[model samples]
Target: MTTFPIYQIDAFADRMFAGNPAAVVPLDGWLPDIVMQNIAMENNLSETAFIVRCDPATDGAEFHIRWFTPTVEVPLCGHATLASSFVIFNILGFDGDLVRLQSESGILTARRDGDAIVLNFPKQPIVAEDIPATVTAALTDAKPSATFRVASRDTDFVAVYDHASVVRDMVPDMSVLGTLAERGVIVTAPGDKPGIDMVSRYFVPAFGIDEDPVTGYMHCVVAPYWAEYSGKANVVGYQASKRGGIIDCTVDGDRVHLKGNAVLYLKGEIYLAD
Candidate 1:
């Protein structure tokens, strides 16, 4: 049997049980695709991140990372990436301040800044598109001021509301929305409180998640969208899920900086029969 270390981390949270939970597994080499998928399913979290060493470097962090949901593999996942960075930097004894990872979406980096880890991710651009009435109807009694579709490869519908309360109170009909887009839907509005620039909630039933507590990846689109409207490069977003979390966003040219805190929840070993 082969044993591997596994860590459960709460990403984008200041404390345990408050943010999105992701399982991070660091591997020596590539595991079978089915094996990694099975592990993600067994974990049953929003996402599980797997990292493996690259190109003749055993200890170097030039790693290749992949993210999986319970049911499917996704192109990009933010919280899981953050959790992976936390595991590599804090738990795995990496001395560098920045960790570079290669994924399906492209090259990504995570930089440690005091208590929070700042993720440098690509900015997803959005364009105004005609609202899908079906999506609007799924969100009953919560009509949006405007709606848009992401122009990037990971296409997600964006719904804009006038009030943060409306965005929070939304109860999307997952059954009706599961087939709407390739990724999911993002509903957002201006923050009601000070120091909070925007508030958002993500629903991706197609990806086996009804709602993501604190989504780091979606903000790649959210931060830029808000910046164009608010005209501020630095903005803070709050994910208004049951398990609430915070994300500090900064838009720079083609990149979006997502900064948040993560807490370690568990460390254990998983056995694989040889």
Candidate 2:
């Protein structure tokens, strides 16, 4: 048997069980894709992140990272990336305040800012798009004011509503949403709470997640949209899931800096057959 270290972290939350939990595995080298998939399935969280150290001169990144859901590997993930950076900064004895990770999406950077970690990610630009009949039918009770799609990767549909209460009370039909061609759907509205600029919820049934508690990647799309709408470079977003989370977002040109806190929940070793 071989043992590998694993850490479960609640990203975007100040306390345990308040934000999205992700499993972080630091590896000496690459594992078979099937093995990683099995590990993700075993953890059964929204996402499991794997990291391998790389020579910056050769690989152009300090670490290479990948994110997997219980069912499939995704091109990008926000909360998991923050979790991995937490492990790197706190548990793994990383010396610097910033860590650069190479991923399928692109080069991503995480920096330590006081007690929070700021993830610098590419902004996912969105454009107005006609809502599909299936999506409209699925959200029959709470109709969206407008619909938009990510222009770059075309991964998710953005549904905009008039009020935060509509977003908070929405009950998505996962069965119908899972059949959509896109990876997921995001519902958002202007924030109703004090100090909050916007509110949102993410549903990615196709990737094996019905609703993500607090998503960082979803904010990559919504932050820019809200910034443009509110005319503010910095904004705070609250994800109104059962386990809520708060993210502070700053939009700078094509990049969005996501700032949040993470807490370690579990630390142990994974035993696997060699």
Reference-based lDDT, residue 138, model 2:
83
Candidate 2 residue pairs that clash: none
Candidate 2 stretches with Cα past 4 Å from truth are none
Leading candidate by lDDT: 2
| Model 2 lDDT tens row, 102-173 | 999999999999999999999999989987878867855777889998888877889999999988988878
Q: Which ranges in model 1 have alpha carbons more than 4 Å from their true place? A: 55-61
**N/CA/C clash count, model 2:** 0
Worst ten in a row by lDDT for model 2:
133-142
Residue 260, candidate 2: alpha-carbon lDDT: 99
lDDT (Cα, tens digit) per residue for candidate 1, span 1-274: 9999999999999999999999999999889989999999999999999998675265334789999998888889999999999998998898799888988988899999998999999998888987678878897677788888878864788999999999888888899888864668889999998999999999988888889889988898888988889999999999999999989999999999999999999999999899
Local distance difference test values of all predictions, in order: 0.90, 0.93
